[model samples]
Target: LKGQIHGGVAQGLGQALMERVVYDRQSGQNLTGSFMDYSMPRADTMPDMEIFSNPVPTKRNPLGAKGAGEAGTVGALPAVVNAVLDALAPLGVKTFDMPATSERIWQAIEEARA
Candidate 1:
């Protein structure tokens, strides 16, 4: 369960911060056709996570257990995005898009300042 949660969170982090599919505007060709052109989350990029499980009995299930599949991933993406927005709130950065790359962040900051 722990491994599943951790892996899901890693996947979520990648989607939220690093994963983007780029295409050529003129030719409609895929720009990020391979791993070399794509970015994924590495071990060094992952944040330390502390997980706590609160098991609640489900009335609909005979086992009284709720599935934890994709639980971490489902929350992780928005959590990370919200965290970044919160950090930049003081800078008047009210909105941001996905794959919150450093370049995009800098652009947001600059726009806010302007």
Candidate 2:
């Protein structure tokens, strides 16, 4: 169970920070056609993850079941995005899109300063 949760959170963080599918504008061809060209989250790139849980018994079901399969990925994307935006707030940045790479972040800062 712990492993599953960790894997899910890692996957979620990857999608939030690094995963993107690029395409050719003219031919509509997939630009990210190879794994080498695509960016995936690596162990060195991953953030420290801390998870906490509190289970509550439900009277409606005898099993007292709760679904958590997609919880990690579902929560991570927005959390990461919000964190980025917040960090940049002091720099006069208010809006940003996803997959906020280093280049894009630098560009946003430059644009805001100008």
Q: Total clashing residue pairs per candidate?
A: 0, 0
Instruction: Judge candidate 1 at residue 30 and give its lDDT.
Output: 98
Once fitted onto the true fold, the runs of candidate 1 whose alpha carbons sit more than 4 angstroms away are 43-45, 54-67
Q: Estimate the TM-score for candidate 1.
A: 0.79
Q: Residue-wise lDDT of candidate 2 within 48-84, one digit each (tens)?
A: 7677778776678889865567667777778888899
Q: Give all TM-scores, in the order shown.
A: 0.79, 0.74
Best by lDDT: 1
Can you give the lDDT of residue 16 in candidate 2?
A: 71
What lDDT score belongs to each candidate, Candidate 1 first?
0.88, 0.78
lDDT of 1 by residue, 1-114 (tens): 666788789989988898999999999999999989999987787788887877778899788866677777898899999999999999999987789999889999999999
Can you give the lDDT of residue 49 in candidate 2?
68
Global Cα lDDT for candidate 1: 0.88
lDDT of 1 at 102: 97
